[model samples]
Target: MNLLSAGLVAAVVVLIALSAVAIIRADRPGGAWGRRLRSRLLLGVPWGTIVSVLFVLAVYLFVQRGYWHWTDPVTIPFRSWSYLYPTGWLTSGFAHAGPGHLRGNLQATIVLAPIVEYAWGHLPQERGSQSFASWRTNPWLRAFVLFPAAVLGVGLLTSLFALGPVIGFSGVVFAFAGFALVHYPVATIVALLVSSVISTVVSSLVDPIVTATVSASPPSAPSWAGIAIQGHALGLFLGLVLGLAVLYRREGRPSAARVWLAALVFAVVQGLWAVYWFRGGGTYVLYRGVGVALVLLLALLVTLAAVASERPLISGERSLIDPLSPLQTALSLALIVGLALVAYLGLGPPFVGSASVAVVITVALRILYTVVVRIAGSGRWAFGGITRRHVAITAVLLGVALLAGPAVVPNLVTVGDDAVPEGETVTVEDYTIAYGEEVPNRMVSAIDISAFGETTQINTSGVIVINEDRHIWARQVSPQQLAYSGAVRLRLGGVGWSESVVVRREGWTAVGNGTAYQVWLDAEDTPTQHAFDSAPQTATPSIDGRTVTVVPDDGEFYLGVERGNESLGRTALPEVGETESVGRLLFSTERRDGRAVVVAERGGTSVAVARHEQYR
Candidate 1:
């Protein structure tokens, strides 16, 4: 719609054109129309998977148009055991938080799925191989049915340990990468560099330009957001293991061993680096000097391995350079250096070290292949037809894709309208509580008591229950219970009770309330209530003993002063969630139920405050 979007669209058009040309050039010439059609349908395009995913995406978008929270029906909630929405395990993969999310996953699926399907669908027949001659072994069945099943299965498995609601097909994409690595290792690595690593780099570089032109916010740093990296990592791990097993059967034990060793080394180094960055402690530091020592160690080991493995056995005719051409060696070296640089600068410390290790492994593999050829003295060494032209094309496409990717994709442009019904009320005994107009099944109620204590009065209100179920439950503060403020704490039924307050003796406030609560139904249909507690008090004294109090009132805070009585000046605080200061005293608030807890501080010293009590 805007200049930035339009530019992105243009870039996508160019990419499509290039892809179409490439596909056409790659197509073989000697096949019948029907045979070619079938081949293209089954292997080239992955029509079934693509169509099904697209259909689901369309439906999700349609529902989101009317009911913004439509994904709630399909979201795989973190740590939830409830099988109430068993279908969500599969459906969540198709659901996305925004258009940008949808486009990113969809693009990845389009690019990677067909390649994986083709590789796995038509396995090369061996001379003395015994095959399972059944429907289960049919290549078509494997491509159409088994592939999707694996994707969904991996998606669901990864969601179990996700820190939050898991959605999108990123896990499946990673699985595709894993599978591709075994069958088409060179191509897959190139794709990963271009698609995942390079694209991210390009996106960040161009974001400022787009932001300036279109008056849009700058894009976030290239870190996983909303999408679960853990899920992707798990899928990749499973894919690697399965792929290795499959490749072992196809390529013999020695070949499989070499691949496994290379992958294991890479995985270990990368995993260690991640641990160092995220969870390193004293032991980690002692063993690896934080991350610096680890990186240096990795470099040493990789260099040694490369040198030892590539040494010329008989000099002259048996040298490492004899089998490989100078161009190939140069290209390999260039790629290694380029990739390592990108990994270090763009992806940070962990990946750079891993990339260096990978470079060594790749070089060692070539040397190992040459040695085997020399020993056997029969078969020619396999280099898989890598050429300067192919490298050039891949680089060009990677650049184009990175530059124009965001322009063609949709992003979260606006917040969706509230879909919750308005004026929803429920009666608990004689008292009536109002459910939040924007969040369904969330109740908030308030009651004022004339005499809660010997000389105090109280006004108490907050969220009683917040759940994702039909029946809502909350603690109803009856008029009779006002006399028993601290003595009789009423336990609110259901889950997710917002902060409720007990205002005692006018000025003295006791703001004890529950944080945001949600009830998760486990696989056994048992419900577990999860809630946090609001902080204790609000106002703090400044250098001059003046205090500013911000009280939570139904999603908004009422800012007031506690200076010399003066009837406690109360006014509506700004909607922005920022700490406000009056003179030397600073005031802040956090959401509790629908209300807020006012946190006040002065001169960095905390002030003790009394809890509010209701007088009957």
Candidate 2:
């Protein structure tokens, strides 16, 4: 047997021996063996967490068809494209992008969710609370039903409010971490380490043996660049809200300092500080400084909100109905305005300054009128004259609102203008897929906003998909992405049906010049159509007063000899290691220097003209 196999076997034997030893040691009376299994489960096994994980897995395997095609699942229809697409809004949080995405989220969920569930507990912790006496206090009901139902509800909220067409259960996973962090900060961090170990084990099991070799890799963006920061923040706030409510009800407060430290570490490590925005044309900009500062502030605010005492901000003997002095009222108003401005501006560039001002004015006026009435008449003050806890909660909620409110403006938009580029397109149901270069990205441009040297009028090149009904005008595959990968398959569907559209790009790169390529769209039950053809590109090499050119015409590439726009002769490009003569120049293709090169020769003098790069 191989060395790895032998080691694995030995490890298994050692693990079995250790298990036997522990069981033997616990066999004595009053030992662990004497206790019921349920007693060790902290009220019961984490059935709710298990059920939640299973539900997400089932959606990926069955609903998204990851069962048949484990890596490439039907994803477009399941994304939260817009409010107009109810199916997408409902299923997006449950559906994942790919197998890797599903695995990563599930790994975190398996570790953190149990902690949150344990904190929730099967039986109520309230004074004199008895299990099974009431439905609210029933252990089985909480473990099997209530917890899972709450998770489902949170999933729906995340999907409905998340910006853009996001697909994944990652937001819910973050929620689990947030809630667990609030309850047991140190344990939550340890759970993160455990999660890493589990991930390593899974990876090792998936590939028991390893082989390494040098190879070219496809182009890819930074890992943190694609994170849905707004959605993640939204989920974290939601969890904090729920956790705080439970904490207050149970009168259990964790160490604020530990919570702050844990929150900071978790947020930074998990890329919650990776605040970024798309710059169109397959580019993204990250505001690292801004993101770090925001996360630090977020940690402090969360700590205060979760653990601060209910001491009134204002001192002295005063009833709830007592009128505040003009100075006090003025200071509160200024504080509100200051927070509003900071929060609003921090959520990007404020797409509509006038609208933002209007919102601030309207909200201020409503609150001002309410406060004036309460001061002039008799009623309980808001949150008992506003304690430190109330203020902290208000700040956190305001931050969440500012972060999430901007998403609504973008989500409310549809493809009202002509987003379909001027090119051959394949239509499936209400969707239109095409390939175009330098096409304006209507999605970003619709806001007509610019900031940090980035403008909304940016252009993009790639495979574009437009669904006016669903309010989707996305550049699915960028030019660089497609060039490196060579092909991409997209799935578009509605409630009960799905169809695939395969995009394949074939090109020949001219030496010292751009690529001459043709893009084809192959849809289900439809004949393959040539979608796009790039301009003819001339090679830098010259032979006998003629220049060899790679020309893409009518879905085929041809080798042409040209002399300053004057075509001497043209013929189909030669196969690899084969020759084709155009006029006095003989062109042949062969692999050299890890690239496919086309050489033009005359009188035994040859020069490499066009080349195609090979990637793994």
Candidate 3:
């Protein structure tokens, strides 16, 4: 069967099994499954938040269907001044790109938001009063106010410095996950694992169908892919900080310290992943895998720490055995080493290096804090009851902030004139030249090159690089590259050049006013340019001559064809390159001082020569 049919069959089977299981446990008293389900529905369902999220999803779908233009209104623009707009700042968190985006974030919100809300909603009021009369003493009121504020606040903060217009509730969802990590660790892990598995299975089954049907949908709808990872990272960091503060307020210094340590470990892993992602240019799959592994690792450690500290909390009795036993230390070191190895092999050396450095810095800071704590004495506060613990926590937080904050800079400041020695450069008789500009345009910038005694002016949409002495300018189309459709139009020497070509069902069409040309094989499998206007141009199977040249009508011309039937069937002349010959007839296309010259020779005599545009 095909992919769709197989997916349908699998889905049906899963549904039937789930239904049967539900039926089996429906009326059973003291049923573990039933009780667990009930607990999730009751305790883990933040009704107000979930309802608001659903409403937002509904509006998103409506907007996608052309009910209104919600994206621009809600999306935070990539400008520092745009943060002043409260509508976009607040609504952007709820605004998503598409259905797929909504699905992933909505599932996360449903599972994690409730757990976060529950944690915040159940905290004991001071003076042993669990009253709802005063907002200050009401956990539910505080949760309702604080959770959404955190979501919008962090979302706005991230979007202000984002590389592009930021939308979607992913940042908030990550924030929820971060909060759940500290408060309801077991439930959070279960939810995350189950959700991840389900999402993977669904994506695997549905991706083929979606890919096949994507052409049917309107292109106006923005893509749901390319998650704002920087925003998510910031949200996660903020959530951890918030969780640390809350844990300190409710549970004691020790619990807060354990949570802080766990957060540090997680932050280190995240920082390493960020380094790999932003600096090392790791793939999305590798970044995601490392993220999952880090979360699982953190969950395991946090759970163990919680269990170890539980006795002290309950009975006020410290364990006789030291917490950092040799075996435990060895296991922790082994785990860290194993993770580093995985990061090195799976991601890259940069990740491993960053992680190692981060770990060392963290360790040194911890040691320094310990020394200060010892010097200050255990019972005495350093200043006004602010002990070394507070300082250590602040230092750890600052370290984490430093690590996560810099990752966003690469995304934001994408345009700069940073010279690279890696690119290919050609040294002519009078000048040295490169294909593209050294600096990349984040949105749209001018390509100004003063090489070969000539000034070349072109509009660049992104990082334009010259290749092999050819005037072929290439740029990476990223979120930073194009702020909006048609935001930047590339032009070369006052003539507009198309950035892309289109292939329709009818035929292939180049999307520019310039002459479209290609090399292909003919019906008889002979390499030749038979008809210039044919839909599928004939391509010669073999090259009878060693070199071929194309003479242009108006622009500069001369193309070198070596070892093939190279045909430029365009009215425009080709640029110059190195010279070569098969027999006695010499053919060369050379550029000197911003000028292209095509020359032909036979029997050691110059046959024909052409000079195009002159250099300055």
Candidate 4:
């Protein structure tokens, strides 16, 4: 929602309101085709808005040479035909026109224009001839086509996945609206008439489930390779059942079997969906069972709504299962709100005053401990001294647990891209996400400490991942902290700041021109100690590509412009007869006006840098 789009929406609202007044009051000439096409939407301002956004999006893509893309489409390097041997098939899809082009795809289900004709099937030329009560007719032709078109519009299918480039509104827009085909108790009107508050609340609670499923696996199975499987699959299932039911009802034939078949098909599709998701290294915990329940619920609702509309819609008209009633819902919400308030305020650990998942895990651990104790008491396995054996085993297990416990604590952790559904669009404390796109908003940031001390040099360079918004930002070169086991973490809170945090490890480098570098490390070598700057802790800087001993045994020191670059000549100290002369003379600098600046010192020796800049 930028400035231009906001203006467009406002304009549309005004125009649609005016149009609605015209159709009812002003003399309008629509008696046949024009009246039918108008439906209810045409008599409002939103329709005008739809027209504006569609027009802008179209203009942005086909013309203006990629209005919002990071670069021109033609300039995207990997997409060129010549690059294919080195690059794989994903080169095209991964290349986006710009943030706006990508953002449109993310908003697909919420609002994408309809297609001229849906890919799944057709709408009858005649209307009211299609009452949504019967099931044999095809209901989804418009919705199906619109979704793929929307997906393709953003290049999700065509450029990235193998099966498409079926991008655009044809799939998602239809898919979102397509839900009504199965749930056509005229949910919009009914929901509004009942209460906007309930509808809004229900939508909020359930939209995540819906978004999660469609994002996990879309319906166009062959095309969704390497994408979230469950989301797409559910979207496809929802669209299909809804569309078919509407088609059937309008054609005047409805069958219960058709609705049941929709569920069965969803189950079968889900099996394949799971296999693909797991094969691609996704967590089974994240995307299972949700899709099945959604399809069944949707299919039943579509059927019930079609049946209920003609008569007074009654609660007993369709059976409600053992459900968590409104009271329970309110109570549960209250409990969660309380917990969230405590956690967000940092009042205590998140599980404080709650019997949460943490409590469950703790109880399970306790149970396991009791079982183990009972077994140990029997002394069945160990022959001579069961007590001693148990003690030893317990000690070893405790030691291992203590050593590995940190792994379980996600106070800070890395989330692999495949670990969570991309659709969840998980947010970290430091950065914001572009909704469903899953593209990182911020990549790199760091800290600086050179201003603190004299003769304290902090030379650091390494790749570091840092939080941009939070204080967790990383820098290859900066003051940092180190863990010394000798100290207590609880007593100190955490390792306080030290000097020279290694942003990049020796082998791998940070990413940027002169900022990021590649670190080349062997598969199984240990990380080197990160250097720390201190009270002028004299250490050798490289000299002539060789490490110079900071203080030679003979009490001598060397000086050079840089440690490794040989172009700078070195001033070697003559062999000292005693330990009195081990340090080097210091150097200072001066501006052209003869004003002293950047003072430096070593061994009580100081020199002014009055030399020209060209001298270096």
Best by TM-score: 2
The CA-based lDDT of model 1 is what?
A: 0.40
Those runs of model 3 whose alpha carbons end farther than 4 Å from true positions after fitting are 1-44, 55-59, 62-94, 122-127, 137-146, 161-167, 200-229, 252-274, 277-383, 403-439, 442-616
lDDT of 1 by residue, 189-276 (tens): 4554445653563454345244335443322212322234345555554454344334433423223333444444433433433321
- Worst 10-residue lDDT window, candidate 4: 484-493
lDDT of 2: 0.78
Candidate 4 error regions (>4 Å): 1-33, 43-175, 183-225, 228-329, 332-467, 470-616
* lDDT of residue 398 for candidate 1: 27
- Model 3 TM-score? 0.48
RMSD of each: 18.9, 5.2, 15.4, 24.0
Local lDDT at 416 for model 1: 19
List candidate 2 segments past 4 Å from native: 1-43, 132-134, 319-381, 494-497, 565-569, 575-584, 588-597, 612-615
Q: Write the per-residue lDDT of candidate 4 for residues 388-419, one digit (tens) a residue.
A: 32333233222222211211221122222322
TM-score per candidate, in order? Answer: 0.43, 0.86, 0.48, 0.27
Model 3 has an lDDT value of: 0.42
Clashing pairs in 2: none
lDDT head-to-head 1 vs 3, winner: 3
lDDT of each: 0.40, 0.78, 0.42, 0.30
Clashes of 1: 25
Error of 4 at 270 (Å): 11
